[model samples]
Target: MPVRRADAPEPERRDLDVRGTSVRMLSGGAGPDLVFLHGAGGAGRWLEFQARLAERFHVRCPSHPGHGGSPAAEWIEHISDLAFHYLDLLDTLRLERVHLVGASFGGWIAAEVAVMASHRLASLTLIDPVGIKVDGWIYPFLFGMDIPEIVQTVFHNPMAALALAPPDQSVDTLAFQYRQGAAIARVSWNPYLYDPLLRRRLARITTPTLLCWGAHDRLAPVEPCAQAWVKEVPGARLRVFADSGHVPHVEEPAAVAAAIAEFCGGIR
Candidate 1:
C-alpha cells in the first residue's frame, strides 16, 4: 500500500469480495456515487485530486486486480476482463446512475464499461485515453520507454511529476511500479494499447461522455485522438487543459475536478 501523509484527507479503506476477487477500495464523501479508475502508474493512493472530488460527491477508488495491494486475477487476459470486473463492482455496491471517471488506461476501461452497459452510468469522463486507434495519427510506443522519458511524456510540467515522486526510489517502490507495468503488459503489450473494435463500438455508449485531454499530451495528441473520440461517442464534449500533458487530472486537479463536478451536476 502507498503511504499517505498525515495531513491529507483520509478515505475509508476496505476490501470487497467481487467476482471471486477481493478488491481493495477507498470510499469517502457524501453525495452521488462517483467511481474513479486510476491509470497504469498510480493506484491505491489517496491523492489530492480525489480528495477534491470527494468534497461534493461520494468517491470510490478501487485498485484493479494485480495492481497495488490487490492480488492478480489470472483470468484477466484482456482489457474487457477489467471492464467486466468494474461492472461487477458497481453491481456489488448497488450503485445507480453513478458518475464514472477514468484517466489514461483506466479511461479505456470506463469506455468499455459504458459500451457494454450505459444504464449503470450517469456520465462518463475520459482523460487522455488511449484505446481507440485513429488513422494518420500515431502516439509514442510506450513499452520500452525509461522512467525519465515516460515522466517527461506524461506531464507538461516536469516539476509537477517530480513533486509527486516518492521520496526514495526504494526496492519496494520499484517493485510496486514493476507490478503495475507487468499488469499493463499483460493486457496491452500484444495490441500496443489500442483495440481494433473499440472505435466501432463507441456508438453503443448512450451515456453522456466527456473527453478531457491535455493540450500538450505527447502520449495521445488532442488533434485526432481526443477529437476522434468526440465524433465517435454521441453528444460527447471535449475539455482540454492547456498547461497539462497526458494526465490532466494530476497536473490540474482543481480544474479537472471542477470540470467533472460540473458535468455530473448537469446530468443530475
Candidate 2:
C-alpha cells in the first residue's frame, strides 16, 4: 500500500476496550508517552506531523468518539463529558504522567482535562484552542462553512491546503465528515463554541502550558485569544506561528514540531 511505501507511515493501530466503550488509537515512537487530541478533521488517521512527534515520544492519537472509528455514546454530549472520557482513558492506560497536546477542538478538550484532573498530566500544549469566549474574537461559524470555505479559513497557503485534499471524496467519506461536524455542533452550539464558565475555570489548571497560535489565523484574532490564554492560565507561555492559519500543525508542521520538542524536552 502507498501508506507503507518510501517514507513509510508506520503507526501501530489498536482498539482499546475501555470498560464497554471502544477507543481507536494510532500509536508510535518510543520515548515518554505523549497523548495528542486532534482537531475535528484529522481523526483515525496518522499524519506526517504525528510521525515527527513520534520521533521523540510515544505518540498516541485517538479518534474522538463518534468522529472517526470511535463509537458515540448516549452519556457523551458536551466537552465536559469528553474530558472525563479521556481521564478514563488515561487510567486505563495506567500512565501516571504523560504530556498532553491538543489542537483546535482537541485543544479545548485538553484544557478541560487539565482542569478536571492534572495529577497524571505532566505538561499541556494548546494549539489554537477556541473554548473560551472572548468578546470580538471573531470565530467563523465552523459548521455553516462549506469544505472549501473551511479549508480557506484554516490554511495560510491555499496550495498547501489543496495539496492535502483527497482526490476522490466518496459518499462514505462525506458522510463521515458530516457526522464529525454534527458531533462538534452538539458540544459547541449552545453557547456558540466557547463555554460560558471555561474562562473562569482556567485558574484551576496547574499544569505547565504552552499556548500556540497562528498569526494568519482567520478563524479568530490571534493576539487577543493568545493573550487571554496566557493571562488566564497561570504561568502559561505563548508561541505564535508567523505564516500559518488555524492549523499550524498542518500548514507548518516542521516549525510546530520543533517548538513542541523544545517545550516538551525540558520535562524529565
TM-score of each predicted structure versus truth: 0.94, 0.93
Best by TM-score: 1
Candidate 2 — which residues are off by over 4 angstroms? 1-9, 162-167
Candidates' RMSD to native: 2.6, 2.5
| lDDT, residue 40, candidate 2 | 78
Give the range where candidate 1 is weakest over 10 consecutive residues by summed lDDT. Answer: 1-10
Error of 2 at 165 (Å): 3.7
Q: Report the CA-based lDDT of candidate 2 relative to the real structure.
A: 0.82
> Relative to the true structure, how large is the alpha-carbon lDDT of every model?
0.86, 0.82
Q: Which candidate leads the pack in lDDT?
A: 1
Q: Compose the digit string of candidate 1's lDDT tens values, residues 114-218.
A: 999999998999999989888877668777888789888888987677545754778977776677778888988877787788999999999988999999999
Candidate 2, residue 15: how far the Cα is off, in Å? 0.8
> Taking the tens digit of each residue's C-alpha lDDT, what string does model 2 give over 79-123?
998898898899888888889999989999999999888777899
Candidate 2 lDDT for residue 208: 85
Model 1: clashing residue pairs? none
